[model samples]
Target: MPDGNRQIVLTSRPTGWVAPENFELREGTVPEPGSGDVLVRNIFMSLDPYMRGRMNEAKSYASSFEIGEVLQARVIGEVAASKNDGYAAGDIVFGMLGWEDYSLAKGAASLRHVDAELAPLPYYLGALGMPGMTAWIGLREIGQPKAGETLFVSAASGAVGQIAGQIGRIRGCRVVGSAGSDAKAAYVADELGFDAAFNYKTAESYLAALQERCPDGLDVYFDNVGGAMLDAALEVANPFARFVECGMISQYNLVEREGVQNLVYLTRKRIRMQGFIVSDHSDLLPEFMAEMAGWLESGEVKYRVDVADGLENAPATFIAMLKGENFGKQVVRIGPDS
Candidate 1:
């Protein structure tokens, strides 16, 4: 272990698009745990779209990331030292920890032990963790896709979107997805078993693409990218369709957010559209775990991850993810897992 700890800190808040100058890589002394804390050697840290919202000064569902402070994310780590009675050294756990070589999980509530024997440590940050749960919650609580229905998932190759599209398939729905590139679209359609998928960036028109992929119209729309694609989804949505608004990455970094010109479709088609935060449904974790575990164990679900090698690369990886450049769930590996 190194005598010093390396961390990524937010230097300045981004006004529009996030730039590399917005962050700094700094080294500090490795910290010791306090009375109720455990010191963790962070192995993998998640990079998510929601973190973009947290960078802003404006108040939102989650607290804003203060400039000059180490940015935080869902991390998979092993306890290196412990001052808490319930924890011991070498325990693999998952926590909302910092983007550093080591972090302090201040209390039991701040993290929970994960079964590394059951799955890979990184899986706790992706498939079996927050992203997986987010996909489940949005589908179960909002979209509620039915058998024979046409389900459309935007950003289908992403962390949550991939799971959402797979779950829709398990529910007997005909799943179609939209991705940024032909390779990503093919990954969803050929590898992930989506009924069909299209590269939205290359398509002549979003509506035309959807028409070719989803001929029956969308009975459920799992929206991760909102903008013109959303307007196109509204145009192609069937009456009484359910729209699950998970995240809007397309508009997240924009100075002037785009307006939905086709919101009138919500009333005209009696479409039920709702946005949700997965944290609000924390009580459903056990239920979601059971359901997802079955799917994962049975080979009914597949997950992909794009891992950047070091903690110093986190900021660049995050910016790339925001630009739809990541192949799947974006993660940063800071330390050896074992």
Candidate 2:
């Protein structure tokens, strides 16, 4: 037996910037399950920066989205019906379930049972999930921040950046962050324990601002926005500095990204720069979650969420996030799972 489902599909692709009109909400019949399948009712949905890359047909680390397909997102849902031996009807799981109220998943290994006892179901899509995992590995494996060293992060109040700064602080680094607004900057510095944070939008000279705050120079630069910020950090690098290229939100909208005028500084400073994605390092998830869970339980870590009330608002909320309108991790609450 198949149950009817409602879903939001990508009606059109964004040529430059995404608009809410680019998405369409449609009601459809729920798919039937095969022998090894489950029907799920989604409770929470995630909005992420990487989804912007998916909107384009350009080649990248991930595949581009096909027009008219359901917009993809990580979701937390309850299994309403199940035929898979590994799962049961009442199991609450988190996975890539797309933007929908319900879905039929057949042998979807990405879907895993979630422990609601660990945190709220929404957390699987935010702090305690992929974003958190990305921060842990980027800081530990790539950035390699050292105690008493200056660690700089852009988009510091976002899902990944927030955790990255916290992790750096835990490692005894002097962490500084750049955010879009004063409030966000204050939150990163005051609440997240970043040694210093600035509103990048208002700063006239990034290098000068960083120099004023991080007089010791940056040993680790966890980059979220590329372009001038990278160039600025390059000029302020300490000997053998490390740069973690996690994202380039600043260049995503531009047809031609700005160049780093200070490339010579990298050679002069002996800096090591690298890029990484969490999907490629899935092996680290088990250990990462255990550590993150312990941090949360011990009050060493804190997370913030910017949530929208319903699935219908998901498109606008996602668009707002891309424009830096969201204060923290952007999530959508779909109807309650039964």
Candidate 3:
């Protein structure tokens, strides 16, 4: 059995956007596993932009938070003790754990055992996990990017965005991406093989910047930062273009959501703009895992991570990620393997 536990809880709901004060740190003795449950020691806890939605007491694809409840997240852990038949001590798995030093795996259905030989454990939470699945489905299934098409992605250096651009490149598309800084832009363009990249923060105007990179026209837009980037993409979209709306980090902290003035351009371009949640594509997870694994093994796809050292920093990491401070996928290291 585990001897110690530390965790982060949502002490208060954020009125408009998340604040550091909303999180509270707590510690206690780790409880032992019971029948059908496995006591797991957390190694890596994932911090993502989606956690912001969970901070507000509002309805969305997932449930909102209640004050003082421990925030939910995905974590990779090793079984310290187990009463479950399928899992035993020292087995590594990833599941919907939370911001904690220890967690109980309730059952085997959602928890997936991982092979570290195949990839690093943290990769299970990033490239081989939800974010990777998101990029795959958004590009191939929703956007349907084809060979020679011009593709654009916002938040291009982020976990999902980086993967999305790589997927676009793999499809033989001419890909351009926008990031928050020059360094991030270079990471996408030079390291990630984006055809062109720009720092959206310094770009005079969104439309002008996108037009400069995609002069011919954008055939597919994998939108991560919604507001101006979406509006700009709409302006340069060719006839029959597709826009996969994955996330909207640009307006996430705004008290009032920014309205796009160029939405009318979508009509003229006959663009198909659609929003998607990853749960909607559960049927494709197995297929995506197979393909992404192949891509990883062959070095066709690569990823980066900005990891914080403790669970107590989860909130700060999440808030920073929304502000474009994190260079890659943000994750928190909670405890060491037993």
Candidate 3: what lDDT? 0.87
The deviation in Å at residue 47 for candidate 1 is 0.3
Off-target runs (Cα >4 Å) in candidate 1 are: none
Residue 117 lDDT, candidate 2, scale 0-100? 88
- Model 1 agreement with the true structure over 298-332: per-residue lDDT tens digits: 89999998889988889989999999999988898
If scored against the real structure, what TM-score would every candidate get? Answer: 0.98, 0.97, 0.97
Local accuracy of candidate 3 as per-residue lDDT tens digits, 33-130: 77898888889988888878877767899888777767788999998888999998899988898688888777654787888789878888889999
> Model 1: how far is 109 from its true place, Å?
3.7
Candidate 1 weakest lDDT stretch, 10 residues: 104-113
Indicate the TM-score of model 2.
0.97
* Candidates by TM-score, descending order: 1, 3, 2
lDDT of 2 by residue, 26-48 (tens): 88877777888888888889999
Q: How many clashes in each candidate? A: 0, 1, 0
Give all candidates' CA lDDT scores.
Answer: 0.92, 0.88, 0.87
lDDT of 2 at 293: 89
Q: Candidate 1 vs candidate 2: which has greater lDDT?
A: 1
